[model samples]
Target: MNKKGYSRSFISLWIGEIVSEFGGAAGGIVNGLLLYEITGSKEWMGALWLIYFLPSLALQGISSPFLNHVIKEKMLKNIQLIRSGAYLLPLLGYLSGEDYITIIGLIILQCLLGLVQPIYASLSFSLLPDLCTEKELVQANSLLDGTLRLMSFIAPGITSLLLIFSPIYVIYIISSLMFLLSYISLLQIPQNSVEKIATWSKKFWWEELKAGYFTFFQYPHLLKLTILSSIVQFAVGATMVINVPFIRGELNGQAWEYAVFSVTFPVGYAIGMLLLTKLPKNNLLMYSGLIGGGLSFVLLYFVPTLPLAWACELIGGILFPLFNAQSAAYFQREAPRERLSQLSSIRLLFLRLTMPLGILFASVSFLGINTRLTYLLIGTFIVLPGLYFLIKTIINRDSSAKHIRNIV
Candidate 1:
């Protein structure tokens, strides 16, 4: 696709992503609050998080062949319908006041989300070839990231304010509307003539599935990136899972403080997105790990006050997106388009699997140690393996530079 042609689709998807992210953020906050109200147990709240993640672990390999086999348009339409239904189910439960069934229904809804997300992920990358130049991919992804961060800035606060009046049904209405909009936007995308692989015999499906796993091994750079990303994901999940409890218990803060901290990360992320045009993209992984990871930990350690903690989060937010944007661009640049979806699915599986472990470990550490010490321990210990990979990748690249120059 030409630059002019790509712009039209890019603009549409960009708008869709923005709306969807805002609605997702709002719905997430409301759902958590409602669940807590219904169950009156932190365990259930944690379980909700776990349920949201478990599908990723289970579906990674299974989804890949299906992703490759299905038509992108058909896949997207089915996904939208599934997601819309998932959104509506909770509203029904909310109105009925059947707490037990509602909890079960909500778990089912999250499971549906887990199924649909990889399809969306695959489609999103597929669209890039139609919607962007190779050179524009980084900026395009940055725009998407920035939009999400901006939505994060507003959604929680808006949802909290709305919760003051009515929480449950409001979120349902909002989620439904957002999904509706997303479906419409997806419909606007022009279907591409994708080359389909010949139907494999029954034996081929198994081979294709195994191929997805082996593909990562064949691409060492991508393999390393995947491992590094999973590590970062684990760290992030641990922080998020513990953050609410930390603010509530250790700091003796209110819900508003939690809202503020949540908002801070996005604010910093917005700032980071703006800075991407000015910075070199090559060293993003290493720089983000050293700066964002280190600063986040330091803030958790020394910043006892809410205001100061927010400041640290803002700084960390600014640096973190650099890491994410560059990593995504790296995958897009290096991976074959036909296999991108499978690779992404596998990557997500590792990430989701490790993230819970990290959160579990962090939670256990918090049981015996002080919260600040737990933060320090995770920052120092858990995050190091990923950082080590990033450092190694950077050094290897530097070492290769001189050899390439000599060859030139």
Candidate 2:
């Protein structure tokens, strides 16, 4: 495609994702609050987090092959509508004055909504290469990253403010609206504009899945990237699952403080994305991981006050997106287009599974230790190796650095 053509498609996709992210952030805050309200127990709140993730871990693995075979654009549209409906489902239960049992049921429904996400992510990335040339991929990914951060920064505050006048249902209503609007924007995208295989061996499914896994392992560098990504994702998940309790109990703050803290990370993330737009895409992965690893420790150990925490979070926000954008761009560039979806699915499966696993580990550890101490220990411990590996990766790939410089 020409630059203009790519720009148009990138803008369309970016708008859809931004709208969807806004809805997602709103729904997340409201769901957690409602779950806490209904159950009135931190354990159950933790369980709610687990429930939201477990299904995606199981379903993404089980459905990977089938998801790989689907028509990418069509599947994305369907997924958006499914997500839109899922956002609306909680409203019915809220309106009906359902009890704890209903809340549990809604939690399960939310899990199912999450099950579609890996497939959605896979399709979205696959579309990017088709929509834009290789030279444009980095810039396009930065745009998507910025949109995500923007939504993350704004959505929670809006959701929390809405809660002041009304019950959590306001969040659900707004989330539903944003999701539907996202779906409408998605509809503007043309279907099956990218190339597809005409036919494959009946064994292709099994072979392809195996090949994806095998390819990931065969490329040691990529495998290392995936593992590091998983670790960082786990660290992120642990922090997020505990953030509400940490704010409310540890900091003696309200929901609004939680919103403020939430907004800070994305503010940092937007900064990172903006930086990526201007910086050369060289040693991006290594540098981003190093920054992220360092920031994680700072945010965990030294952010004694809300203001300081916000500062650390802003730094984390910046580094995390840089790591993700660079890693994703690298994978997209290196992976074979024919098997990209399957490869993407497997990578996502690891990322999803690691999150709940991290949360579980963190939750269990929290049972025995002070939350702050736990954060400090885990943050410092996990980050060091991550930083070491990231630096090693960059040094090992000196030629890749030279290639990156040439691109710039």
Candidate 3:
């Protein structure tokens, strides 16, 4: 820890993450907006996300076997540079003056982006502990998680403003430049010596992967926490699909209304981020966040008007960071430093693997269920498990306390 309470490296990495997240978020909004303009199909919007998720997960599986050998900082810089190039590719297609070709270019961009995102995300998540002391881990994680979300909200507001005066494609141009800046900022981090690389052998690689998974499963709390977190990710996936449509389709909103609805969650998230550091980091708080967030969704199911729905999202956003920041810090602190990167990827694989399932769940109108009911279902999924964990944690604590008292 530094006298300023955060290391210079963490500050550097945090700034880079913020810039990169903003760029990514801006590019994402542009991708959706441009693609929707071209196709005007809700199904295609879902498909675009699938293109990103499927390839990303496949790469995560392929890359996890070898992550222990890679240098984190170098790989982060390389991925950002590649992302910069990838963001620029669609412009080339636009310049070529073919809508179909531009669409194909966008698919190609998404595929490349999918390939790199898992590695970048896992590396950065695992690398934070190295940048900050154990004491600083929770704050660091909160800062990163909170700001990444804040950027997601901030980008849309910025995009909405820019759309008023400029073209949507212009956001992509800005995004490409933003990523380049992230790459430059990443260069400030001093590199560490690379870990000893494992020699190549088919059998050896397979065994290493099994060992990573085996070790991951061995940590019962970690496994449990991961599964619980996966439920939230599932809810998140559904939200990603439902948020815009629910606000626009069901509530009869336009771009400005959707933008306002979008911004509130992250605005609440920023406030939660500030509040998390002042609160206790424990299972009770984490599970409360899970339950509170889920209830917020259930609240939306019955919200009779647009303003009420916005408040539901705001409350959900505020409630979730309690779990997100603490759980992330716990994962970083719990995983062994030597294997942290690989384990982090494995953990992410499990968490991310479910989101597509959730997206698919949300995308499909199962049995005539409305979008609000879909939100209710996803929320219920989160709430039930949260209650289970909350009860379990309390029971265990009471049992431990009783045994202590009996022994005394």
lDDT digits (tens) for residues 1-408 of candidate 1: 234544776787887777777777877887787788888999988788777666655666476766665567556656766776787777788788898777777888777786677667666765565567776676677778877778876877778788788757878788868877877887777777374766777788788888888887899878876766676666776786678877888788899898888888877777877787667667634455444655586568777788877787788777767777776777787887777767776766676677778778777877787777766766665356545656776788888998899999
Residue 134 in candidate 2 has what lDDT? 82
Error of 3 at 44 (Å): 6.3
lDDT measured at residue 284 in model 3 versus the true structure, 0 to 100: 91
**Candidate 3: minimum summed lDDT over ten consecutive residues — where?**
1-10
Q: Which 10-residue window in model 2 sums to the lowest lDDT?
A: 1-10
Best by lDDT: 3
Give the per-residue Cα lDDT of candidate 3 at 139.
Answer: 71
Q: TM-score of model 1 relative to the true fold?
A: 0.85
Better candidate number, 1 or 2, judged by TM-score:
1
Tens digits of lDDT, candidate 3, 1-408: 246788778888999988888889889988988888888999999899889988888889867767888889999999999999899878777778888988998999999999999999999888888888887787788888888888876777787799899876688888898899999998988888386667879998989889888888878878888888898888888888888878888889888888788888888888888888788778899899989999999888898888998898889888899888878888888877788888899889989988878878888864367888998898899899999999999999999999999999
TM-score per model over all chains: 0.85, 0.81, 0.90
Q: Model 3 residue 80 lDDT?
A: 93
Question: What lDDT does candidate 3 reach at residue 67?
Answer: 81
Clashes of each: 0, 1, 0
At residue 273, candidate 2 shows an lDDT of: 77
